[model samples]
Target: MNTISSALWPWLALAGLGAFHGLNPAMGWLFVAALGLHRRSRGLVLMALVPIALGHALAVGAVLLAVIVFGTVVDATFLGRGAGIILIVWAMTHLLTGHRTPLRIGMQTGLAGLALWSFMMASAHGAGFMLIPALLSLCVTPGTGVELAASPSVPISFAALAVHTGAMMAVIGGVSLIVYDQGLAFLRRGWINLDILWSLALAGGGIFLLAG
Candidate 1:
């Protein structure tokens, strides 16, 4: 049971972090929603998810690939500690700056533009970086070539990425639909902000990586 729990927690963490990113308006939903509003087309909103998701996946995949490459040469301890510190510092910056990104990619963007915007936003927000802790938890420590490739960890990493991205898309679609149908007034009326919680989560993830 302990072993099972230990293995399961990393997948759970990936899903949870995905959900958290999905919940963040700065991620992609808000921008897509605004774009939908501008175009007056619900279909466009739904369609846009494709590109947004693709872009996000690419950003995350790039990070994962880099991690995998580094995992072969660099020590896991060093990588984890470095990633942890980066996450903590990134979180501090987000908290201090109030998550007010200078991103002006606007609603006029086409699908390609939206994809680029999503990629940039995800990269800027360190969305993929947040997954490093959970990611490394699943990978074998400092593995090399075929040894690493033969392990279940590589396939599991792909599964983790799919699971993470899927969870995010689910939330993004759900929230976007609600906002489209009901309008933005509801958010203005009584929405609880999650930016602070996000920062805290990032910092907590950092601490977890470091302690691990």
Candidate 2:
């Protein structure tokens, strides 16, 4: 049990972070739900998730690929420490201004628009950055070079991305259902501000990377 737990925790953390990102107000669950409601089609909501997930995966994958390549040249620990400080600085910036208005996507925007918006949001929030500590553990072999050609870790990195995005979609899909059924009234009345929480999480991720 202990052995299994130790091996699984990092992947679990990635999933948890994905789930949290899914719920971030900036991710715009309300907009997706409202759009589905306006159109009177639950299928639209499900369809919307596909693009959103794709955009998020693309955003994170782009950064992960770069990191994997760069890891070939630098010590992972040094890179990690650098990332940690960056995360903390990003967190502070986000905390100070994260609640500012998100990019406006009209209610009538198409799936492609949603995809673009999601990509921008994930990028602006530094969502991919939050996953690096866990990802580095799962996919990047310490003191190794060029994982793409010679290492099994390439496959593992892809799996990690899938796991994170899958978890995110699950949360977003489930919440969209609730919001669709209940309408915007529930969200308006029930939703609480998540900016501070997200900021703290960002800082926590930085600290975790630093601790390693």
Candidate 3:
């Protein structure tokens, strides 16, 4: 029915955004996958993903809450710029220090570790900022646009979190599987070290946002 279709739009939009999040290497899933590959344990790798996803969701959720509360007063551009600067600083620090391999997923990532990893990765990448424009665009317009911004009503916030988390897990899991199955022969021989490439990509994205 038209009613059902209309109601489903926002959720679908959030799902699309979730997929978009998966597409980005800087989202931390790649690092999670790399950690998994290093450990040679799929379960451990997948476990590490939980905290990373939670952290990303929490970061975005906080931003969404701020937007909801201050929609009338906050300057979105300024907030975005501030986030960009923060990300640039984070990237610069990493670049200066060099990329260290992430810890393997295991019992080590307790609740505290989960919270810390999630917050650090999410904030460092400005993952929350990406949701702001998308959310505002959706809430301000109706039909497809509105559905894209928010759907399932206020509950859409949770749904967005689920979508993003699920998508990232799936991507990391798939990558881990492939890497494990393929073994390190090709990886070692290949000129491209995906880990380095991913790190540089993160740095480049941060720099681009800061300069823009």
Q: Provide the overall lDDT of each model, using Cα atoms, as 2-decimal numbers.
A: 0.82, 0.81, 0.56
The sequence of per-residue lDDT tens digits that candidate 2 reaches over residues 23-123 is 87577576679889989999998889988898889888877776777676777777788888988999999877664436778889999999988888888
Q: What is the lDDT of residue 107 in candidate 3?
A: 39
Looking at candidate 1, the ten consecutive residues that score lowest on lDDT are 141-150
Q: Looking at candidate 3, what is the lDDT of residue 3? A: 70
| Between candidates 1 and 2, the lDDT winner | 1
lDDT of 1 by residue, 75-169 (tens): 77777888899989989999988654465786777899888878888888788888888888787543322223325656777888899999999
Model 1 segments beyond 4 Å from truth? Answer: 98-103, 141-153
The number of clashing residue pairs in each candidate reads: 0, 0, 3
TM-score of every prediction relative to native: 0.90, 0.90, 0.57
* Candidate number achieving the greatest lDDT relative to the actual structure: 1
Model 1 has an lDDT value of 0.82
List ranges where model 3 is wrong by over 4 Å: 1-13, 72-115, 142-153, 184-212
Task: Please give, for residues 1-212, the per-residue lDDT of candidate 3 as tens digits.
Answer: 98787566555655655665565555555555566676667776667766767777787788776655554344544444454565556556666775443633453346457556667655655566555544543444332211222233256556566775677667756655565567646346652434344445445544544453
